[model samples]
Target: MARAPVRSSQAKVVSNILEKHGYQLGQYLGKGAYAIVWEAYFKKWRTNVAVKVLMKDKAEAEFLSKFLPREIQVWKGLKHPNLINFYQSIETTNRVYIMLELAPGGEVMDKIRMKGACDERTAGKWFEQLCQGMAYIHSKGVVHRDLKLENLLLDQHDNIKISDFGFCKFAATDVKNLKQVQLSETYCGSYAYVPPEVLQGIPYNPFLSDVWSMGVILFTLRTGKLPFDDSNLRRLLKQMIKGPIFTQKHASISLECKDLVRGTLASDVHRYSLHTIFDHPWMLPLVRERPPYLRDMDALYLRPHLRRSTQRLMTIRHTDGGTRSTANLVSSTRLVHPEALRSPSPPPSPPAHRPPLHARPPLQRSWGGREEGGRAESERERERGRGLAKDGRRRE
Candidate 1:
């Protein structure tokens, strides 16, 4: 008889492997159609990591055999600091998990939820960073077709980490037969973020579709939601299929944000490229001046579990311990004393009782007889642990 293939996942074993690899699970961040993300820590670097656990099921054959490999390939080709880091992959007999750079800030959507809408300054800045990341990926010949608030992750210090490359394409190689590839049209991505050309039968420019998505992101960021109105998929698709014009509810939005959305959302086929939208005046300042805030906002909102990743940036790290960068490194910035950037303190430490069993002993034990010796030893161990934790901080 043939040997049986493994059944029932080794969840605990996989979890242990993650911990051993310096990844400690923090929380259940989110899950989508294929994978679940757990906030984790990479102890080696004292940073957070997003562990994407791909669910294994008989129905997930297509994702595992096809899309997963493509995602890995696209990620491996990418090397920008602003993009989310894809660390390593965990393979078991049945399931798969990928460890990634955790964004401490959370998601861009959270920012909108917190402040209603981002100001022009913030929106522009973020868009510029989006450009940088997109440009980098595009330069590498990859097009992130799905560019939206939900997919754009953030790390501590507010840096954007473009994520979910599930729908990404290796443009340089994918266009092996441009005619066949371009002509093929099978829709994917969030309904709210799809572009007009995608809705029509036309062979769309992936870059332009990305631009429209970016416009949508900006509109939502500045106004707390999308620029369109629809209650169903067919209706939304029909509305998005039209020309690039958006009628703003003036009572609900500012003229400035709506204007940018109007100009950026055009489907004239000529105006949808990032090269065109990025050239706008409102976006120019953001292109030149808004990285820090955008990055910081990313940290505060999108990747809160992935802390300290943005604590030091090439932009500011070169300065003389200042927030600004100096002549040492061009355009690189770093976070100076980011611990100071912490949120309103966490719930006060659980009532300090006997130092938990797991805590390293910190005090000196007494070498007395029997009963007295036992009591003293326990006290000494805790004293030593507290001292060590304090000393480690002081040394830093």
Candidate 2:
């Protein structure tokens, strides 16, 4: 049955649901193009939940009516410890609210910025959780078309919760039934992390594209740099066609990690499986979720460990005994300033490493042209106040 649209008297019921559940929006977690996340409390669990308020736009209004109902249906039956829990969804004319697991640590990008890239052991743990999430999503027949560091959010315990399914698709269609979708294009998703096939506008295997996206994520996590950079898209595409090799020996990373990178970058269409890269022993620690006491690991190890107010999982501390600050990351998201946060579509795929079967968009050097000093792409400055881009670009 078609779920009744959220309007008129129903909107008030939505708010009542929140009040009834005793969850009050505490602080705004962050925002996306059409969504804003807020930290709220669940009186029953006495815990925090990330309430994703996906607003209704002229373009998205109709989509949400169908999308939200569909998402709720799908989420209702799915249960897994690793998966982010979807508590409830309520809708008003102004917004569709999805109550989700709150991961306060922010995106992996936040970690990259704070720590300048993590070590192999740290990177592997993340890789394992990511795959576990992907594996779960795959098991449910859902294709998370968009997978990036930003999409993978970290909990208070620093465990990742794979969120954001705005671009997801259910595998209920065959070539004949899905013909309409099979021909779809627009290179949707964060550009820098997009798979090659999607860029070429071809029918893509969802799982493979997701893993390729994962590789880009791993690359960014360990190297503190993008893989397939060039002066221009033409050059980038040429190198991609030719297959670029990445050697991170200068970065003081381990050979096992390098092997992982190589394994991740190896994109033979014939050799695709979660176990393909999943079999690596180094990835074991990450795939297994840390015990409930993980947040306390730092406390146990640090000379003067400070227990966190939240779940007491493994405590994480740098060699200096100071915890990495994710405060900046949590607040710096474009959602903080919705009117100014419209972004172009993310550079969807073809990481700095090997090119997928497709050529990528031009590598944008954010560093101003000759007008600016000889700053590389990383040095580009963004004004704090800009409107959203019609393209699905990231707010960054």
Candidate 3:
């Protein structure tokens, strides 16, 4: 399904609202089922930023009452070199706007599509960064259920910046005297990266499920293809249960690399925890790359063009006490803007002459499906999944 085109009047209304909030809306970046991402320039920060606008009327009740709030809470609590920075979240009656760090280098999956697989060094470097970021997320007790190549974004320096936390949730803890791990029942995330336990309809540790997805990501990075075919759910589950099979394509990858992949994709009991993964022989030797601020300090000091912009980024501090290169301090005490106010009043939408809801085109693919074969294949996969559920498997 495709998103209805934004009418000129609707665009003008959104731009006006953003302009009042100190942002100058630029080009349309992309759109999903109920949200649209736009490129905008922040007057105060003096840098390009991405704004994700979620249409209230279009969003489902579950999203409004559950996932959206969870995403905002988890995103705000996080601050890390490899994680995308969250600046501000604003709500008007008709829409919810989330301001975020702009990653100019685009999605990591796009790179795999254009060039083939990454070499050992390139894959290792990014994977190390991802592990560090995920470790931080777990320490904060947040589990990002949706972990895939498409969600791994890159900045101007080609550094990894994990994005999209729509399905994120805090790890369940014991209600009685102490904190303990609790298994999750929800079946979320892309089918290609989901672990076997999740597919089996059993309560599973989401942390381990995340580790499994990371294995899928690493394998694809090295081999330029999914380890198991996901065109059919029954076939996919069978392959996962049998475990990943090494082919001629995996022959060139180092022994230690193969071991690491195997360990992560292993059944829950044998799988390595994030801490154990960091201590693995394959990961132990790799040096985590320095962030841009530290790595390019000398060059930035020498060049005026780079120094001016870089210094500005380094100066702004989030209230969380971390020094981020690309985030602004959006604390209530520091600044107050009209747009930041969470008023219940509705903002104007397109004029009454706009097309009816049913008359509009269907929505575009959101964060849910993989883009390997584009929309046609995605729709077919959904149909097949529905058929499986009706057949009494009730796979969800």
lDDT of 3 by residue, 1-396 (tens): 122245688677778788889988877777665778888889998898888999999886767887788889989989999999999988999999999999988878767765667899989989998988887776656788778887899999999999988778777463222134555777666666877666655556777888998998898888776776554444455566556667775788989988999999876666677766777898887756423222211111122222333333223312222111211100000001112112232332232342322233433333322232344344444444343221111112
List the candidate 1 regions with Cα displacement exceeding 4 Å: 1-11, 173-184, 241-260, 289-396
Put the candidates in lDDT order, highest first.
3, 1, 2
Give each model a TM-score. 0.63, 0.64, 0.74
Q: lDDT: which candidate is best?
A: 3
Total clashing residue pairs per candidate?
A: 35, 28, 2
* lDDT of each residue in 1-396, candidate 2, tens digit only: 122234445334444666766775465444444565556777778887777766677335445556556667776656665566778887767667788877666666656755666777778777788877776665555666667666777777888777666556665244222222222233455434554444343444555556667777787677765565422222333333333245544357766666676565543343235665555655654556433322221111111111221111111111122211111111111111222212432332442443221232222111100111232212223322132233233221
For each candidate, C-alpha RMSD in Å? 21.8, 16.1, 18.4
- lDDT for position 356 in model 1: 23
Cα deviation at 378, candidate 3, in Å, is 4.1
Measured with C-alpha atoms, the lDDT of residue 334 in candidate 2 is 15
lDDT for each residue of candidate 1 in 1-396, tens digit (9 for 90 to 100) = 121232325445555767676666566655543455666767788876677776677325656777678889888778887798788887877668888877778777556544555666677667677877876665555677667676777777777878878767764433322222232243444445666445432344555556677777776765555655322323334445342333443355456556667766764333334444455556665664333322211111122221232232212323322111000000000101212113232222232234222232322211100112343344334324322221111110
In candidate 1 the C-alpha lDDT for residue 268 amounts to 35
Best candidate according to TM-score: 3
